[model samples]
Target: MTSSNIPIATPTFGQLLRSPVLLLAFGFGSGLAKKAPGTFGTVAAIPLWYGLQFLSPVAYLAVIAVTFALGCYLCGAASKKLGVHDHGGIVWDEFVGYWLTMFMAPAGWLWALYGFVLFRIFDIAKPQPIGWADRRVHGGLGIMLDDILAGIYAALVLQGTAYLIHML
Candidate 1:
């Protein structure tokens, strides 16, 4: 393999988190797999949720908000560095989107599944803000915005369902 192809540094989990390309590449890894990579990526987020939920809701929200903003910058940078727009492998956006989906929902496998399915649908469907972000926004913001919006929509659906089910 080419030296350029290899990531040289000891992979810093935090740096990877901050890297738009890494995130995008992760998502792409899911996208490239014959099976559902999106779902896999969403599943990958469960560990983070276990930790993030420990913080006060306000703290959690703040972290998510920061992550969203950082995602925009890093995603755009990585896309440019890789000389591609919205590469399939970048799944960091998926990570954040899934995080958004569970923001208010009762933490349960059922709710997560619902959020995951709903998030994947809206992400793929790209309706309204998702559509708008996909088309108009450029760079990392463009890459991540659509999924985040989808997350928001899915979160609503999941939360609503939870309310109806008396799970919230």
Candidate 2:
């Protein structure tokens, strides 16, 4: 059955705390927020992004790649365990997407904020292929794919903006 047909129920903090996989899938409790859990999850990613900035670009990309693969498993498994596909509480996708959005972003809090805003806009808007993937894909990959697309879109916009600023 598709996510639309599955009834969604938020997992309690105790439930999350008991399952390591669920905790990570839930963005280390950031997804526990009653409202805008995705936004909170993205916010939770900022500290990680800050640390990732010290890595070489290639290393950073590798980290994202690894995390993306992990997220596919984590998100999928969490959905299966919860009996709900793409539960809003499964925000691992947001963590990866926000990181991808900040890829190669200019080094500064301002740029980080810009990346956050851009990523949120693209993720929330879900234009074109992003929305398509969300509708068409299934399982953990489905949960991650849409956000990956959104991240790509946001990254493009963020990089372009940085380019413009430098050019001026």
Candidate 3:
């Protein structure tokens, strides 16, 4: 069958939640949104970031490490089941990416919002290495890698901006 003609099966929300991988891959149902699922997934990430924000830097890093690993597995598995690579519904990457973007960010709603905006910008823009990874990678690691890079890029910019503001 032609690539376009291949059938892609998307699991229902009930089906997705039945599996740990699918549940996370769908961003706890945020990815099931009829419109702008990625945006919804990112929004869902905000509260998680808030909860995780208080972790010590070392603990935060540990959590990010684990989340990235879990996201890679779950995202890959869900994409395989859905018969699509990087399906829009596979948004665990977005969740991890946003959390990483806000890592160690100063405590404030404004900072959180800024991190959200910057992460979404970099993710959607897919500039440089992020775009390269997205195009060339496959499977679960591939699914999570691009967003991870985007998050790192956003984190750098966010941290640098905070530093500059402090210096000023």
Instruction: Tell me, by TM-score, which candidate is best.
Output: 2
lDDT, candidates in the order shown: 0.73, 0.92, 0.89
Estimate, for each residue in 1-168, the C-alpha lDDT of model 1 and write its tens digit: 113774322223454566545645465344444456566777777677767866887988997998788778766766655566776656678889988888867866777677778988998898997898899998888888898899999989887887888853
Q: Looking at model 3, how many pairs of residues clash?
A: 0
Q: Model 2: which ten-residue window has the lowest total lDDT?
A: 1-10
- All candidates: TM-score: 0.78, 0.94, 0.93
Off by over 4 Å in 2: 1-8
Instruction: Write model 2 residue lDDT over 21-136, tens digit each, in one string.
Output: 89999999999999999999999999999999889999999999999999999999999878888998899999999999999899999989999999999989999999999999
Number of the candidate with higher lDDT, 1 or 2: 2
Cα deviation at 119, candidate 3, in Å, is 0.3
TM-score of 3: 0.93
Quote the positional error of residue 75 for candidate 2 in Å: 0.4
Give the poorly placed runs of model 1, Cα more than 4 Å off: 1-36
